[model samples]
Target chain A: MSDNLPASLPGQSDRVVQVDKLSKKYGDNVAVNDISFNLTKGEVFAFLGPNGAGKTTTVEILECLRNPTGGRARVLGYDVSKRSDQAQIRKRIGVLPQDFNAIDRLTVRENINYFGAMFKHQLDADKLIELVDLKDKRDEQFKKLSGGLKQRVGLAVSLVNDPDVVFLDEPTTGLDPRARRDVWGVIERLKSQGKTVFLTTHYMDEAEYLADIVSIIDHGQIIASGTPDQLIDTHGGKKTLIIRDAGEEGLKQLPQGLPKAELRNAGDIAIPLHNGELTNILMSLAQTPLHDKEIEVRRPTLDDVFLNLTGRRVSEEGN
Target chain B: MRSRIYTIISGHFKSWYRSKSSIFWTIAFPLLLIVLFGAIFGSGSTKFDLYLQNQDLSANTPTYFSQGYITVLNNTGAFNLHVVPAEQPDPLTYVKNDAQLHNRGQRLLVIPLGFNATVMSGKNATIQLYMDQSDQASASLAGIVHSVTVSYAAAIAKAPNHLILQQVGIVTKNIRYIDFFIPGVIGMTLLTTGVFGAVNTNGSYRELKIIKKLATTPLSKIEWILGMVGYQMILATISLVVILFFGYAIFGVTATIDIYTVGLVVAASLLFPGIGMVLANFVKEAESADAAANAITFPMMFLGGTFWPRETLPDIMKIIANFMPLTYVNDGLRYALIYAEPAQALTNTLIALGLASFFIVLGSVLMNWKEE
Candidate 1:
């Protein structure tokens, strides 16, 4: 949102990050198995996985902060394995790691300014502070800041180079609800500026909201990858129909093509929508339900999609 | 390249200077020791007790030779004579009793029999001096007495007399404790600011994930480390000048301020930042890094030549002191400051340069920006 982040140069490459069959292992333990992904310009790709699921390892490889054990990864069209290319990639890419921090002894402005000096070309530090909504805190020492403010500084530091691709690993893990929303706002702004954002988070709702493309990993392998609606449509459970206070005659009047109806504990007869029959069954229910009865149709959510894909809640799988 | 390094150097400097604790540790701490010790011992004449026994059987009353020698001794500003009554113990017995009690600074002077007659007759006279050998306090006092006696005898005889002592001195001036102490202070300040600053700050940056973040930048670890060393040297150079100036201002202590002394300190400073980086590789957390650094530095502080010369140490400790790096730092600065011989400090400077190279390379090996 700041002019300091020069308009994404018109000649920038389309694929900001690309990975194919990347893997990482710590001695006998395989941290990341072969995985492949790619990012086009101005897209927010959310990489979600359980703990030890290799999401971080994948991101770290793309950020050039780790050496992949097998296969190849490139950032800004440069092969990450080449030492010469690493410098060039680092110059063009920004990374905000899990538990990232700015120098606590330095003020916010100084922290950003120091990081800005690390690159050949940099955004204006004062403008970055203002962009991150830290104008009043520009001169305040980082140690005295709250967690949310510190993360804001980390965000500003990540943007110092006006990077082509930004890696935000678990950017909002420990934030409160309000701070989480504030950071989400910043990510939204980054996307608006045509910056390719590679994000890894456990918050399915976050992935659902901010991600244009989503990839789910488990046990060092990607279990599913697609747009949020596509993943939900593919891996999600059947839609549920709940009809309350329906008389026996109304139940008898229901469409026969619907799957066997069962009475739920909440005094509602719940019916599952069989494949390709949700629309017809819902229409039949609309015709049968009395005026006083309550009726509801619940579609599958991202959390359900994650559970259906991984067989465990995202929070439970990660922890 | 210069811009990247300057960024890191300026960033480090701003962080270090703004902290009150760092300013105290780097500048105030050393200056306090130098000024306090210099004031305490730099501006005074040493005082020792002397008891005189008259055994001049050849003289009837107080003779000129005996009275004149006593007056000379008193005027030398070195002796505080104890007025004893006639019933007091003999000078030797009094000195022995003082020694047995472990008291310090008591000495005895005995004027020989026929003292005035023998001296007036132009014949050599021998005066006996007694002191506590184990106490280590009588060396200066005994020197003063012997010189006064021999000179007075020469005046009476109209010729010089033969007298021998371990050290040759005219006793016109006493060397101040500060003059002997300023070099040690400089050595210590450089050691602390260099080693502790490097170890603690680098280790803390690692612990806090600052280093990991910096790794994402285009700057390499070598550049990062060199930048830190450059910054510390600037701080150390400024501190060296200011502390030496305060030494001269607060007390009349003078140190040789030549290019060689500056080189010794600068070369010495370049070694520790690398050492700190090496130390950080082994220390995991900020708090533990401080403990580990103190564990290494505290013993070196007392055992190295900073507090006392290595020659005074026991044979085994001397061998250990030779291995401790700060000993060379102390010795190098001591040579430059006192003897004005940078050539003599050559061996130490080379070793410091070697260590600077070794640890910096080793630090780069241990510091992997990619490793979690």
Candidate 2:
């Protein structure tokens, strides 16, 4: 894999982050196993996992917030485990924590300007605020803003240094749909500007849309890592039968010995379609009650790949 | 790094000053307390007024017990004696009339006709006293009269060669309570700003992940501490001025607001944040930090001679008072202001500075941002 990676890439080939057999343990509890991966320069790498799947622990280890129990991890060519390299590493990378907030009394502009002062090189604060679409709210105190606006301010502060690499941990968690889209726009701009982004998310659609590479981690291990299309092609089947708004009684009207599908919530059944049986299944279900409802045949998504690899189910919430 | 420190200090000040409620709490609250306590306790001198009626003057013996008691009470300058007139008759009428005219601690002392005869013969003698039980000042007047009579009786019972205990007035300064209380109120205000303000700032930042954001930057822990303590010092200085100005203007406090008093405030500003940080190190959340600050400061507010004097505390509490940093703050400021004792002020300053250094070092060592 390493030989192919080096040869297939044209001229630019450099690893921005390298982790070799890294592990972190709290007494007897191992939060991160001996997992290893490398992030190339100028790539958006997504670490996908459930609540305690060691995604944040690994990010903290790379951000130099925690110490590793064994093996090595480096950021921007400096060892993260060494205390001497911290000042250097911090100057080059920006981190947005899970519970991040600013001084509630300061104006939004003031908060961004305050963070800019902590670095040797910084972006123009007004321009940065405008980039996050907060120019009109620059004068308002942080506490006066809504939760969504506060997240936008948090993102602006994270980019205050114009860092080479930015770490966003669950950046869009607990946000409304519109605010989530706002953050996704900001993330896209960060990548298009050639900044390497390391992100972790519980939303499978987020990583599927924004990530160049995705790793599915579960119980302190990475079970799969690839492009979204590649992973879906490998682990997920070709097509799925999506049935919506059909009642339980309606679903029971289908003929026996027909191509069956997995039952989803609210009278919906989505399953991998069997090969060469789609015509036969439709003919058998023509007289059934399910034919009156909405149905679709589509390709497998990264969500299906994720469910297949980690055994974490997709509920009605749609990830 | 210097820019970062300046940014933090200025930002802290901006946040604190923008809110009208903060100004009222940090500046106005202490001023209110100083005016209330200093005005109530400050104006009057500690002198009790006594109207003495000598019924035994005509039946007096070789050793006049009334004369001896009167001599002791007047010699210490602790009592103002007004002889009850013969034409006026009742001592109680004289005292009641005096109380109606002046709301002072006025008392009536009547000597029985055979009082001196019984005392010379070594028999028990009774003296009558008229007091105003409703008045706070009159509550202590009876105790003073009793103590003085006990001393006079001891002098008469023992021989001429026996123990002759004399009360001397060495303090000489007719210092009112406002003069004594102004410095203590200033000390209290400093403690409030330095400990509670700084500790809450540290704890909330840690709780909100603001510290984590800074920790990820190039900001070191030392820079963070210095920026916070420096801001607190500024706040303490501002509080000192408000309390003292009201003390002098309204309550007639006489302490010269000089450089040494300012130095005491500055030292406190530098000192108490370390104490606050030490307490903050033991807690993980902001609410617990507030409770911890209260746990440390509420006892100190009473025992450090803030509203009450240290001399008034019990023996055990007085011993505990000696160990608090605010005690030294109160001591140094009092000595500088009320007693005009430079040597004592210097001694207190040294102890406070030494303790401040210890707490700052211990707190810095224990300020761990990483959670398990």
Candidate 3:
């Protein structure tokens, strides 16, 4: 496993996290298998996968909360598997575990300071609270905050130590859409401050929106790794043209020479668009009865990229 | 490390005071129990109740000397004397049942059958008194009986030494039920707060992923456990002071805060929470761990002599109480605070400290500081 190490060791380079063929097992079951990735400084690296796709196991190993069965993982230049190195790693890294809740009776500021005190040095709690835009709820107990505000407090706590790198495991997993957006705003702010963030999420849009580099993992292995646009362009099948509210009648009324169209779930007619064919397709549709129907071109997303590669779509709940 | 542990302790202390349920359990409920138990058993008639079973008979009539002895005891007016039939074979059992029924002290005074003959012939006669050693009224009652027996012997036989009064099972200490109960209450408060506090913090914090988050920080597991134990010590001290003060204010119960008392408090602070951490590790879920904690603490409270003396328990329960950690704590508290027996208190304190070490070490070993 040491042979797989890169020429430049951590701290010698800008690599904040380096995993060399990391594997974690539980007796007979393998949770994370021989997966490798690297996170550089000031980059938001997203490990995207479904619910049981070993995301948490991998993140915990990097956080020094778990040991790898076979291989090596280092965080902030310290080996996670070594006891001496784990202490160093723990001192430098910040972590927000999946479904983490702060001390219930503590106010938002108190909770932040409570966790902050675990470090030798901590960023100001008031500054963190302001960064998360939770100034009004600073004095409120954690249990009294809304889910969005509670998550904001969690973000503040994770940043309390002014860590070299932050690990956030499914930070917005169970929040409403608006809450998810609010959390995204906090992550954007973190990015603007040039802090390296290692995020694990099942939400493809979350990765597409926030990550500079995305690794899509499945069944304990990484299927693809690149920027969202690169993965989408390489694996995303085809962009389509959709006629809004146009029923099967729109498909039936299509011009004879046009590509075959199918009716979708919302009674819209969809026709695949190939490169350099958009102008010609529009000219063909201009003379048809369906030409008057509301029509627009749709681009492929990370969802399409995942579906095209895996032959299955991850549900909204990451099933 | 010191600052981290201090922060954890401060955080927990703040949470404890902020929650109404926590305040109610840690402070209000124990005080309430003390008030209720004190009110029920702390006050009563000032007169001692003594049961007399005169077996000395001549043709089923009381002999002259025995009748004279009974009259002398009555004239003292220190006892509300009740009569047991001379024909009763087992007077102790009868007194036990009768005394319990009437809410009186289970003490009996027996006169021998040959009292009249022995006294008239100028030979020695014996009067036997049976009483529980721990009874608060035993010393005074035995003293009265002794004085009456001496004067009666001098009046009837002209020899004060001719008649003997044998006091059985006597320990001369004027201790009331409240005094005994106050120490037990302190022990009880230490128990519930330590156990429930540890269980809820460890179990529910794991569920909330707070432990997981803390594991990623610079804090070590030892620091966290030390913080918890430190918090428990503060809480234990609070309970001791508040309950002792309340007991003094309400029932005039005075207690000495000796080194042994401090040792027992420290031991209990580690011991109960150690048991609780062990429970939480096994039970896993917060609610189930709570139920498990109840299963442990409720039986220990009742069988550990919290509300009554182990001597009053059935033989089997007394034997069981010997193995309970709280029994030693309660016993030690009573010795140091009320009884002032240094030797016994030291023995119990050592035993409690030993158990505390074993459980706390075992609990620390079993706790999952990191995800496995």
TM-score of chain B of each: 0.68, 0.70, 0.78
- Candidate 3's clash total is 0
Q: For candidate 3, give the lDDT of residue B146.
A: 93
Identify the superior model by DockQ, candidate 1 or candidate 3: 3
Superposed model 2: Cα runs more than 4 Å off: A1-13, A314-319, B42-171, B257-259
Ranked candidates (lDDT, high to low): 3, 2, 1
Give Cα distance to truth, residue B223, candidate 1, Å: 1.4
Off by over 4 Å in 3: A1-3, A247-263, A283-289, B51-124, B130-171
Residue pairs with backbone overlap in model 1: A51-A318
Q: Write the per-residue lDDT of candidate 2 for residues B198-293, one digit (tens) a residue.
A: 788889888778988888899989998888878987788788767767776876666765566767876787778888888888886889888999
Alpha-carbon deviation at B158 in model 3, angstroms: 17
lDDT of 3 by residue, A1-319 (tens): 1226563554776888888889999998989999988888999999999999999999999998888999888787778899998988887888889999999999999999999999999999999999999999999999999888888899999999998898999999999999999999999999999999999999999999999999999989988999999998899868899988888777777887767788988999888888888899998889988788899998888888889879999998998
Write the number of the candidate with greater DockQ, choosing between 1 and 2: 2
Per-model DockQ against the true two-chain complex: 0.54, 0.71, 0.82
Q: Candidate 1 vs candidate 2: which has greater lDDT?
A: 2
Poorest 10 consecutive residues of model 3 chain B by lDDT? B94-103
Q: Candidate 1 docking category?
A: medium
Give the CAPRI rating of model 3.
high
Q: B1-372 in candidate 3: lDDT tens per residue? A: 889999999999999999999889888998899888767765567788898999998888999989999998998888899999898898876676455434578788999888888888888999999988789777888888999999988888788999999988844345667778889999999999989988999999999999999999988889999999999999999989998999899878899999999999999999999998999899999999999999999989999989877765777998999999999999999999998999999999999999999999989999999999
Off by over 4 Å in 1: A1-13, A240-298, A316-318, B35-46, B49-144, B147-175
